[model samples]
Target: MTATRAIVVMGVSGSGKTSVADGLAAALGTAFIEGDSLHPAGNVEKMSRGVPLTDEDRWPWLDTIGQALAGSLDAGKSVVVSCSALKKIYRDRLRQSAGGALTFVFLKGSRDLLTARMAARHGHFMPASLLDSQLATLEDPSGEAGVVTVGIDAAVETIVARALDGLKTVG
Candidate 1:
């Protein structure tokens, strides 16, 4: 990984993006941003109501994430962000906004595992019902440049380690 790369931990709901990204930022000695926290109120309301956000709803949120990444990079600090980033266009938008100095850690998992994980969570605005919509929106980033694809079936530590190992090859 480069000295100042902005890393995005990406996947559908319940894929452990937060746990992994937090670990990754700690391991890298950088700051971590929870992408969901940056969502506008309206977007959060929609999701909390079990409604999938439209592309119109996502652009502003994506831009906010991008700005956060860019701001951190401008301060010469490496940063890790947790985001769904479910589509290629969304990733591309982030890449552009971060001036191309971005890497993504894509958490890949089976639907059954993801559903189970979502069901076990509590107090989150996102509902397990929205998992299918997120899965449908996801465009696998496996072959994309600057992307590290890691399986999410392991313990958080193991998964973070795997992601760290994978990030080593990102340019």
Candidate 2:
């Protein structure tokens, strides 16, 4: 098994965060956290109504995720968490909260691919309309500390395998 560490599966909506995160957790023999579940009820409601969350709307929820990441690490366990950490600042906040190093797996894909994926998705609160906003918000993580980028233009299994490989390589 890999060492106990937080692996944040980050990407825009429809970038296969859940599937990749789940695969990573299973591969790493660790726990998995769906970050959207940590959102406040109001946040969910707002997003469901097509309103994008502002920083104020996200702070408390981000704090929750940070705490969970820190707590899990303190307990000597690894976790794979899925979060749309679109901006560098958000990633910084999460990394600080983890209280240790975070290995972020950034799922990168084209706008067309993402749009198709989002359109095909069912039962997700985020609408396909939000993709452009998210894409605009994303600050490329190129050469950032403790981060690895993986292309989402492949099969889930291939993506997972590549991510695991990348993790090993980066570490």
**Tens digits of per-residue lDDT for model 2 on 1-171?**
657789899999999999999999998889999999999999999888888888899889888999989999999988889998888889999989987578899999999999999999899999998888888888988678888899999999999999998898664
Residue 145 lDDT (model 2)? 83
Write one digit per residue (lDDT tens) for candidate 1, span 1-171: 348889999999999999999999999888999999999999999999999999999999999999999999899989999999999999999999999999999999999999999999999999999999999999999999999999999999999999999988887
Off by over 4 Å in 2: none
- The count of residue-pair clashes in candidate 1 stands at 0
> What TM-score quantifies how close candidate 2 is to the native fold?
0.97
In angstroms, how far off is 139's CA in candidate 2?
Answer: 0.8
